[model samples]
Target: MHMSVANVVIIFSIFSSAEPYSGQPHIVFFVVDDLGWNDVGYHNSYIKTPTIDMLAKSGVRLNNYYVASHCVPSRNMLISGRHVIDIGLQHGEIGYYPRGLPLDEFTIADKLKEIGYATHLIGKWHCGCYSNHSLPHNRGFDTFFGYLGSSDDHYTHIIMSNGLADLRLNDECVGYKYFGDYSTIMYANEAKNIIAQHDENKPLFLMLAFSAVHKPIQVPDVYMQYYKSTIHDNERRTYAGMASCVDEAIANITEALENKGMLKNSVIVLTTDNGGGSVGNNWPLRGRKNSHWEGGVRGVAFVYSDLLPMDVRGTENSELMHITDWFPTLVKLGGGNPCERKNLYGVDQWEMIRGMEPSARGEVLIALDTTRKASEEYRTGPFKYDKFDITTFAAIKMGKWKLLTGDSTYRNFWDMPDPEYGVIDDEDFDDTRMVRLYDLVDDPSERTDVSEERQDIVHEMLAKLDGYEKAAVPPQMQTKPRLDNHVLECMGPWID
Candidate 1:
């Protein structure tokens, strides 16, 4: 069913009446890139982040939030209340959907706009390209100010705003220059300007997606100097500095809100697109981004609202929530109902945020694959069930019992394969790999394999995993490998 442009506008206007705001609560979604679990001050990092720490202290911290192991998929889940697989986005396919989000699908931004909120998206929009029919403007946002492609040099930024190209600087598109050494600073400035000049009569929904601390490793002199003397490794030092810059930007945003007297009436949510990058420390977790391990998918998340009261502040929630939950959560908060036409995988977390009952949501399914092969895991309650042999499909963490299917063929912090499991040490760290399980409650680091001792539990979890795969949307055909390369080339060279 295709609606005319005029019809779309009318429908949007009608939805806006659903949430009659004498002054509807505003939303500021601050999404960072490639941030680790313990990289910020609240997470016990050596780096200083006074701003983010304050947000955590004054808000609610989510201890068990999860996202896809990669960026585009996670963002897809975030915008649409469905798993990445359900939308034909899996295994880090950049620009997979050339078209923007489907028109039939409803988004948090769309729901907010229905209620008279002015929706805006600024910064990295990796969800799709500008030519795609689902650009930010078409997806219900009133405005868009950011780059269509992913990862660019901070010094020379390439941005697309409101479906236009080569945006003007002082009435001229040429000689346009980006101001800051970091993209975080530029995004922060745009957000501040938008907030300051916004019509106070209408509530706002600003999606501030920062492309900081992702790659190409760039940082300001002040931040670099501050971290060089404090952090140990060169790579970690660069990452820490970049993260600090994001914290500073958040400070500027909240301060602007408070000055406008909108802090109490606003909902601020802070989270990363996915897990940490190569140089990150997942800490007590198991794997890095792109892996099925807890470290790769688990992320740091928090929410702050003055309407909720102070005694409820700084509460830690261990509910099982994922990126897909955001769409439903936001829609409900903005006084808009979720579209009931199709099944949505996400559950609204508003009740959880209100310090209500523990999350009834259960069992997150994760899949990883190369061009020709695939592997999957089902995490329910405290157990993880795998498909391949314990060795061919290694690294299962069920509470304290962590099983290594085989030795570490990958170079990671935890080395040494269990000899008792018939997994020997090969030069590349890949041995015949047997299914060896350990009781993690006793050996938290996965040093032993107790699979032989606890056959009943292992079998039960395996059955559960089997059921999840049968119910999940089947995997899609892998797209061409160089799609991301082509996108980068089209965007041209990064300035800095």
Candidate 2:
């Protein structure tokens, strides 16, 4: 006997409910843009961020948390519970396609909805800019009030609600607007209003994605003046002001939760989409936002829950975790089933947070320029293998031992054959044919190359890197770029 689609859904629901905790938790995910690892006061920042500091003190701090090197991909991973490359999302600037989040593939929001929760996404819906497929309303959000694109004027914001461009400032209907005073403050007020109006009977899943501490560095005069006194650098001063706005917003949100008596039953998470830009510092790690270095991927994260003890509330966890983990972790916390059928990349970190699990153990694969549109690097454990040139793959580890196939400058030993293809595009230009290895443990800054003394380890790591690349998804087979017509049909007109 053949089963109908509804039958299949019923069976899936039954299977999902077989677990002990099948109820959904009230989730508030506060994703910040370009916020540095050390930008918050809890992370040693000079700027005053009392709200975030309070949250950190009341919750757990993830010391080794990681995210995509950029925004869109990181957000995709958080929602989809997959590596950015797995879903054909590898870049930040490119908008989402129709096939971005397949309807068949369940999302965090979808799962929560299934278990009886009200979903709302407020701010920066950058998943896609197409028609029905691009907006949060189509994805699983019961309500969506935010901009379809990335950055825009704060006051005259180009906002979309439930797939319609209905928001306007004054009498003119403009896409962009000056969001009088500070945008963060405005977003905070909006969030507070939404929370206050939420039905208390059902659980709420609110995604508070903020476009603060990002570029175009605009801030309200009040915050700017306050930051100028504490921060010396011009750029940092603006960053501090933007961060302060986010803090105040958080304060408003927490207060709303407290007043509604949902604070004890809710799980509130505050984290950055990725590492900071050149304007911010990711200290102890090298490199910035776009690179595969630690500085580019590491981010600031704090989780608050009333269930934990006060003494352990302000604790720190150094276990390595990534953005993908949030999906499974949230699901588990909400008493939902962790995916058991497929081999998902994320780990259920809820146990770790509750002191039930010892540490997070899983190898994370990061794809750099998976489309071969640009250069990229790969890191596993303490090892870093990169291909900056078409024929040179350099491997670096704890010590200073380095390896290279070609000469120091260009033609040192140019007779070597190109290295075998890893998980990247062969057509894309890469200088990995010449193998260069470095001991980076002592020389963490990677100032010198010592490949000459480490031929044995170099050969081993080359083989390992080759193995990893072979296991990774190739560029051509990645997500195909959708046609404009198809995009329009899927998402609707740019502004409907």
Tens digit of lDDT per residue, candidate 2, span 1-496? 1123343334223322222223345788999888876678776657667778867866899876778778777877888787665555654355434435444456788767767788888777666644455457767778776655556555545323222232222122333343353567766777788789988778899988887887757777667686665566666677777787777777778767766866656778988987777566565455557655555666789787765545557799766677889988887777666574545567888777766675565334444342342123323212334323313222222222323332223111111111111111223323442444545446543334455465567656556445544554543232454534433312232433
By lDDT, the best candidate is 1
Lowest lDDT block of 10, candidate 1: 415-424
Name model 1 segments beyond 4 Å from true: 1-23, 95-103, 158-181, 368-454, 474-496
lDDT of each: 0.63, 0.60
Q: Give the top-scoring candidate (TM-score).
A: 1
**Per-model RMSD to reference:** 10.3, 12.4
Listed in order, each prediction's TM-score against the native is 0.77, 0.74
**Error at 69, model 2, angstroms:** 0.7
Model 2 scores a C-alpha lDDT of: 0.60
